[model samples]
Target: MAGHDLGFQVVYRGETLEYYRPGGWVFFQRPKDCGGGYWLGRTYDGVFMIEYERPVSLSDGMDFLASMKKVEAKSEEFDPNYSLF
Candidate 1:
């Protein structure tokens, strides 16, 4: 698992899987497999996009995502809008 400042990003290639967790909301892209390549991205507005030439297993994708390390903010700078109440 990896750590970032936002939320979590999970990556799976071949038999290896990696996980990343940041402090913000978690987001993910649909998995894809093709003879050439695939592309996926999340927009700043929270829109997720996935383009693939072949189908991918949903179970594998979810498993990879679920393995993301849980990360919590250690400082107030992580969330300026946080309320103590």
Candidate 2:
């Protein structure tokens, strides 16, 4: 599938992220409830980075997500159940 056929755009910090269904999913991790943090997305192109406009504080938590060094992955390695959310 091509990007235009089944793609979605994600807007963050006034930036647009063009994601395609055939390109798999964009994966990233950010801080939780400790002011505004950064959002990094691992897409078929490269690591997508975004920053919040303002900071907001709340409960604190930490989570580490795997980094995608390269955009291309083996078809068998693709996870159907995987999602960025």
Candidate 3:
């Protein structure tokens, strides 16, 4: 971790870089030592503001995730005679 200037080094999911672009969000996964692996995530709404900040912690990460909307995928209806074409 020497010479690493990042606030917190994240494993960087494939989509993590998306946040650099407009209309994208990013999430960072904590190391095992950081409370058995939890996620520290944030959505980039492209807005700037000033507010309080604190050192990242597992409990805080879980609380943040809890406030964010959960993602769910929709499944297609099952069909006995569905065509592959």
Candidate 4:
């Protein structure tokens, strides 16, 4: 496993957590909502869409996530695309 220390955005409900870099794949490991274990997030296309990975335990999840840096979403000028509206 390569060092997973790339600045990524934390995805909250409704916020567009889209990003990319010129490298291999980047992923995120977060605690599961059900509280059993944790789930992983990955990219799809160019947008930062979250794809799940095999579930891991809490301790394992934290350790895996720790390997990667956490970045809170930064969209000071987050404007919605309302072409449909």
Candidate 5:
């Protein structure tokens, strides 16, 4: 979580997605390989990462992620460091 700050890079499959932290909200675009769209990125705070249903524009995805939030089983409950969403 070192680069969770605004404009930090989130890397997946060698692809890079930029993240933004406005106020206490952290959002990042999901890699296409993992299914594209923006997600409510993980935070050091209590907020858990949220996934999107369909691919979306980065700005719109970020804006709507909270409302689109889904319930996911906590990683620590079943599999360590593994979130099922």
Candidate 6:
């Protein structure tokens, strides 16, 4: 599934950021005035990164949150030794 290709990495500042997805998702680690909001997207072939600004609706945020929850849940099902990191 597409979500399987989606992963995340913690940046140097300790913020958890999404990565390697077929398409990007917007992330706001801070308020807008601080340039805190940005879109992290993937290329059409899902091999590159694209950053941009776009208004994200509440429903879209909810959906992304739900997907994140699922990812977390799945992570719990794995054996500790299986962790790639």
Best by lDDT: 5
Q: List the global CA lDDT of all models.
A: 0.36, 0.34, 0.37, 0.44, 0.46, 0.44
Where does candidate 1 clash, by residue pair? 6-24, 7-22
Give the range where candidate 5 is weakest over 10 consecutive residues by summed lDDT: 66-75
TM-score of each prediction: 0.24, 0.20, 0.25, 0.30, 0.31, 0.30
Encode model 4's per-residue lDDT on 1-85: one tens digit a residue.
Answer: 2234533333332343355453334434344454544344556565443333675554564556555533323434465874655
Query: In candidate 4, which residue ranges exceed 4 Å CA deviation?
Result: 1-6, 22-39, 44-62, 67-85
Instruction: Give the better candidate number (1 or 3) by lDDT.
Output: 3
Candidate 5 displacement at residue 16 in angstroms: 9.9
Kindly provide the TM-score of model 2 when superposed on the true structure, using C-alpha atoms: 0.20
| Model 1 spans > 4 angstroms off | 1-43, 46-55, 69-85
- Compared with the true structure, the alpha-carbon lDDT of candidate 1 equals 0.36
TM-score of decoy 4: 0.30
lDDT of 4: 0.44
**Candidate 6 lDDT by residue in tens digits, 1-85:** 1233334221222354344334544343334565544343333353545343463433454466567669978886757586567
What are the per-residue Cα lDDT tens digits for candidate 3 across 1-85?
A: 1102322223333433332323222335444565444343333466422111433444464455344434212244467898999
Better of 1 and 4 by TM-score: 4
- How do all the candidates rank in terms of TM-score, highest first? 5, 4, 6, 3, 1, 2
Candidate achieving higher lDDT, 1 or 6: 6
Q: Tell me the number of clashing residue pairs for each predicted model.
A: 2, 1, 0, 0, 0, 1
Write the residue-wise lDDT of candidate 1 on 1-85 in tens digits. Answer: 2323424343334432233222332233334444322222223343334422243344443444345332223333466797999
- The top-ranked prediction according to TM-score is 5
